[model samples]
Target: MSELSVTTRSGPNGPVVEVAGELDHDTASEVRALLSGLELRPGTQLVVDLTALTFCDSSGITVLLAARNHVLAAQAGMALSGVPDRVQRVFRILGLDQVFVTYPTVEDAVAAWPQQTE
Candidate 1:
């Protein structure tokens, strides 16, 4: 299993979390903790960039849902991008596709976020 790593950067809309490696039972909690520490503002869009994500299991899926719930509770938006075909398939089979907004790339996801007016 690949070692899980998460990198973050600021985007125009909000923070972009770049997740790489396997997000399994062991690493799901780490991801959850990282997400929990974020300071999300209302209307901001939190983009999870999965371009380098190697694998994800049920535990990872649960963490993803929890992240979504967190963002929603803060009145923010959330999106996932660069999902691997295998991971995307799992989401489709579980009908989570309907729950999460997905994009082809992080750029596309970030671009789609609602622009904030000063």
Candidate 2:
């Protein structure tokens, strides 16, 4: 099985979590834990970068949904960036394409974030 790596960095809008390698049952918890621990605030946006993700199973999908819920509960927005075509197909098939807001690049995701009003 391919190893997974999940890293986070501060972005202009909020936090950007970059996930690389396989995201299957074995590694889904790692991603979930990190997401659960994120300090998202209202009006902020969270972007999950899946550009380097090579594989994902049902467990991975569940974790992504959990992340979404976590962000929403914090009153923050969320988006997925650099989704692989294969995964997109799966999302489409499951009707999850409608559930997630996706972008071709991380920059696009950040740019799409709602501007905060002073």
Candidate 3:
């Protein structure tokens, strides 16, 4: 199994989380914890880049939901980019496609984010 790794970077839209490796039961908690720690400001857009993700399971999906909840609680928006076909199919099958905004690339998501007016 590929080990999960997460990296973060700040963008004009908000925080960009780059996830690599397998996102399964064993590593879901780590993802949750990392997301929970983010200081999401109201209207901030959180983009999760999954371009490097190799695998995902139910637990991983749960963690993604948790991240969305976190963003919602902060009055922020969340989007997923670079989702693999395997994972995207699961989201479609579970009807989660309507729950999160998806983009073909992280740049697309960021560009689509509502700008925070000064």
Candidate 4:
């Protein structure tokens, strides 16, 4: 299995975690564990920058949902940024694209994030 990696970058709003490599059952657990410690305050946007994600399975999708729930519970916004077409197809098929705010890029998401707060 290819190793999964995560990198984080922060802005005035909040942290955007960049996920790379294969995200399957085994590696998904690491993501979940990391997300468990996230502090998504009210109005902060937690953007999952999925630009480099090579692969993602059902377990990965579940972790994404969990992340969404965590941010929503804290009244913060959650967004998927730079999602590959493959992943977008999955979200579209599942009708999750309608529920989750998706952007072409992190900048686009961040630009819209402040609007959601207001």
- Per-model TM-score, in order, reads 0.93, 0.95, 0.94, 0.93
Candidate whose lDDT is highest: 2
Over 5-72, each residue of candidate 2 has an lDDT whose tens digit, in order, gives 99999999899999999999999898999998999999899999999999999999999999999998
What is the Cα-based lDDT of residue 74 in candidate 3?
92
Q: Residue 37's C-alpha lDDT in candidate 3?
A: 94
Better of 3 and 4 by lDDT: 3
Clashing pairs in 4: none
Error of 4 at 92 (Å): 0.7
Backbone clashes in candidate 2 total 0
Candidate number achieving the greatest TM-score relative to the actual structure = 2
What RMSD does model 4 have? 1.5
Per-residue alpha-carbon lDDT of model 1 for 1-117, expressed as tens digits? 449989999998899999999999989999999998899999899999999999899889999999998998889999999999999999889999888899999889888777522
For residue 91, model 4's alpha carbon misses the true position, in angstroms, by 0.6
- Stretches of candidate 3 above 4 Å error? 115-118
lDDT winner, 1 or 3:
3
Task: Encode model 3's per-residue lDDT on 1-118: one tens digit a residue.
Answer: 4498999999897899999999998899899899989999998999999999999999999999999989999999999999999999999999998887889999999888784221
Task: Please give the RMSD to the true structure for each candidate, in Å.
Answer: 2.9, 2.6, 2.7, 1.5
- In candidate 3, how many Å is residue 57 off? 0.4
* Number of clashing pairs per prediction, in order: 0, 0, 0, 0
Q: Which of 2 and 4 is the better model by TM-score?
A: 2
